[model samples]
Target: MRYIFILTVLLLSFNTFSQPISWVEQTSGLTTQLTSVSVVNDNNAWICGYAGRVLRTTNGGANWVSVNAAPIPLTLDLHSIFAIDSMTALVAGSGSSSFLFRTSNGGANWTQVFTETGGFINSVQMGNAFAGFMMGDPVGGRWSLWGTTNAGLTWDSTNFYLPQAGTEAGWNNAFFFEVTSGVWFGTNNTRVYKSLTLVNWTTQPTTGQVNSYAIWFNTPLTGFTGGTALLMTTNSGLTWVSPASPLPGTANLSGITGFGSQWVVTRQASAIYLSPDNGATWSTSYTAPAGNFRHIAKSRANNLIYYGVRSNGGISKGTLLVGIEPVSNIVPDKFELKQNYPNPFNPNTTIEFSIAKNSIVKLAVYDALGREVNSLLNSELKAGEYSINFSAADLPSGTYFYKLSTGDFVQTKKMILVK
Candidate 1:
């Protein structure tokens, strides 16, 4: 029996996958919930929270030094954190003053950008280095999403939804995984909604009511929002499913992140759970010493998973979860990988595809001579359709072939490169 168990562990480890998470402590050592976290490369990350505080990490999360950015610390409570670049960031705190701050030199220092003096910011995501947005629950009149394209210099408004009786028009929070893929969720009437650009927004039906935070799409189509019962989605936000979460009862789900195959979920004071099978099941990672989870992020540049609780300081990891699901149902019609947009482009183009199930797949670009130049689908993919940008800045204008291969199934298409 011991050998069998060992073999199973070995097999699961070999697959592109997940493992449990372990974390250290923060410096300030506040037992308050550390609400938000963001990581770049492996060393740089930022965590924000209650009492108008933001914590920065340069050595992953081994240790953290608290940065008191707010002029008036006790006035606002930060709810969300977004790092567009090493230096550029946007922080949303509770209350009307959307405490928007920016750092030019990788958080060494920060400057106050814009402050929405009325409604508090619930969540924030960078649309680009220049453009980003912040969302909050219905406040003042009827506004949900706000956009800033000029490096927080100016703004635009969006009605995430108009308040309805049973259906609240406003969102509890908002976060963007990419320039296109974004999600906005709330408590009372509004559950959550999704959008590609900042333009058209669609409400995604969640399992139950969520109050806290959510982490979405390790890659698109696969996302988990932390709320009532760990709401999950296989299709970006086309549909939402309520899965059995690790929390004991009706608890607010906040921080969530994925490393390798393991996903970590945190609730206030509740032990974090690491899942290998896409949240189908969950186990403990580490019990938070105190505080509630507010934000989480996985550094793609490196494998570090950074986390922040309401007031637990901020912690980060150099390694990530390693549990992966089996490659299943390699069915063609089950998925639809769209052709590259602007087939005959000079520098950049977009490639889109869909998967019916989670699997380790390969997507590569080949020149007309059959020599492979680039590969995109090189990691474990969650079930859903997605589009990725393929920038050909180094290649000459010509014809190329981009293909998708999984197990024995292979598909290829011809693309023209016009410089």
Candidate 2:
């Protein structure tokens, strides 16, 4: 089953693998082809698809309401919806020449802020209202990038261009977001590009067409992108290479992104895939909100991944767990388990810890009694950094004990909790 989750608040001090959760169906009315799903935070999200279809819900994915947008004889195909903030957003699509829609009230109303210079506006992105760029297929199959400085009220039309661009049909998607710095991707020399000022589309040459069928970045450098083959670039798009993945037999990838720690990708159906180590490998257990999932969105706020799938057999709801993020603040404040961060904690926490040498580190927790209650970290850990989590919902709420053991280094700490 697929679920489009929405959380209200996010308290992130660290990044860690979060406990697994499922997606819940909030709305079951429309059946148009979903174009883009944008999530600003946990509780705020917007999804726009085909035939002037745009849905908004502030209550996560449990409920949805079509923005009964003030009638304007909806003409342009609303292919994408980008929630820049809970109030601000931008959307664009193909039909009716090419157009963009902006909203400052969570879709309560929308404004046709921009239109095409003659081409199907495949995707739309904005660094700010004063700085924006739109790219799409040209008349002769090539692609062009247009920029703006006046809140998209007017565009500069042409600054970056890609010759003989491939058809966006059946091709993956592209996105320009602020990750570490200004990052952009689509296909350039038939590959991809990354720019700082959204100009001078620097070509990061690659060997694959539609290499990043679906691309997403976390930092300007460290990101996971995939197409026919899964790819990971640690230094922006300067270099490109494929990673060895255990995906379900070279599955046709539709979209890819970094959620929490693992890399999430959608197959064709409601089925999805996950990679834990930057696409070097994959897991078959990954799942998202159930349905004939057409699109998915993830919010860094609450470590939740949502999906918009076709409610199977008359549009029903389902859920799936497709990826894992590290548990933020998983390390006991008094115990110490700090490693790296950006994990998928239920509430998005970070954990850090240090071990001297190899030992039987049993960071277990017991509920009330001294009996072995639950094992948060029960493995032969190395002598380096360690991070783990005692899932909030996995165990009951009460006094818990975390004991670490080595040869001569054995310590136990007590911690309190409130659900």
Candidate 3:
């Protein structure tokens, strides 16, 4: 399965401010400090943590099975995990000799893919099914960066380029990668390094912040990094600034992930903060009863559902009630495509539509030449009124066309981008 880390910008027509999120704590049946969580889909998920503990849930966290039995060392503290599916995954652990393990048979057997003595692998991310990257602490003054093009079957340490590290180290799960956007990672030295080409590098200081442990981007030009403090950027990473209001807690942020205007972050404390309007403001969405959260992840198949792992073996499943709610109880009599809000939009706009019956709908944007550019919606939705927000930050200013299509219905409209 190819995993592409692209944040799709689409908002359903609902009052997100009043949308209630209900979180239920799932039973992990362990007490170890869970470090990272990965949601492959709505039904499959994985969590890794200390003592080489790895857990898997195939039925949407209704039951979690322990997959760390044989051939997996009990002393390794697994820091990060990338789940390709329920039966295949790659996990990296930090120790005197850092190790990367890949399991193809649901963790019943494992193969050591990469190992480096005196190294600590912090993050492992796959851009797609074939290409991936892994980063560890500086080894012998050079960043221990590895790239793999064969789906983690083998890894290459050389040929891939990175800058030297001068006594700085990266935090666990502190990296972001998008095939078209490049890679970024934060460090303990108040600096974040970015490379568009993966060879030429540049650094930007997160001024006044000592550490940046978590980083996420909604678009190529908008992102956020958090640790001891929270910093945001509107023009990529060229500049960073703190939000107008501070996060609810004083603890460091350990995980960050979201889609569209909805943002979620897990702090070192018991609370998970959420921003309904892109990172401008935050409010406490859920507070655990016992330990702090170490990592949070959103489902790739469903944006409204996410999972957060705690420091005490607790997994919380949160569901956001932000789906396409009907404008009224009555279903529409005919299909309609409304004009996009704030036409001649500057980088962002909302397109509304309605369907007369349940159908598989597709809404997409096209360039002036009728080439498909962005796919906003392509799913089986019930008959209702819906609106989706689209971002054109990565597109040049020009005239664009948006088309809505179903099995028996099709419509197209024009919109303009000013900048």
Best by lDDT: 3
Taking the tens digit of each residue's C-alpha lDDT, what string does model 3 give over 1-419?
A: 11111222222334443233456678999999999988888889989999999999998888999998655689989999998877888999978988999988888888899999999999998888779999898888888889999889998887656656668999999998888999899899888989887777789889878799999887888888977778988888998898766767778989998776667888888887778677666766677878999989888777866899999999998765453333455567888888997999987788888878766667778999989776555444556766677778888899999999988899999999997
C-alpha lDDT of residue 161 in model 3: 63
How do these models rank on lDDT, best leading?
Answer: 3, 1, 2
Error of 1 at 47 (Å): 1.5
For each candidate in turn, give its C-alpha RMSD to the true structure in angstroms.
15.1, 10.8, 14.5
| lDDT, residue 368, candidate 2 | 60
Error of 1 at 407 (Å): 41
Candidates' lDDT values, in order? 0.59, 0.54, 0.81
Error of 3 at 300 (Å): 1.8
Model 1 agreement with the true structure over 1-419: per-residue lDDT tens digits: 00000000122223344533335445655655567776766667777777877776676554677665535356777767776665666666766556666666655566776566666666776656787777765555655567777777566784454443353544323355466555454444435656666566666666555443555566676777755667676777666676654444456665666743457666655456667777656555555555555555677465545554544553434244233233443333465557888878877787766666655556778989999776443444445454556778778889999888765457888889897
Candidate 3 residue 179 Cα shift, in angstroms, is 1.1
The candidate, 2 or 3, that scores higher on TM-score is: 3
lDDT by residue (1-419, candidate 2, tens digit) is 11122211111322223233332334547756565677766567777766677776675555777773743235556655666677777777666467777777767777776665566675666665467667665656555567766656666656465555455432324665662377566553446766776545577665664555567776667665556565667788787676665455455455555554566666555555555566665543333345444445566454444454442311212132333333333222233433323333342233445655534445544556777554344333334455443345544446655566544565665565545
Off by over 4 Å in 2: 1-21, 68-76, 128-130, 139-142, 149-151, 161-172, 188-190, 208-211, 249-251, 259-261, 285-291, 300-302, 308-419
TM-score of 1: 0.64
Error of 3 at 212 (Å): 0.4
TM-score against native, each model: 0.64, 0.64, 0.73
Off by over 4 Å in 1: 1-17, 29-33, 70-74, 106-109, 158-174, 210-212, 244-250, 259-261, 310-318, 321-419
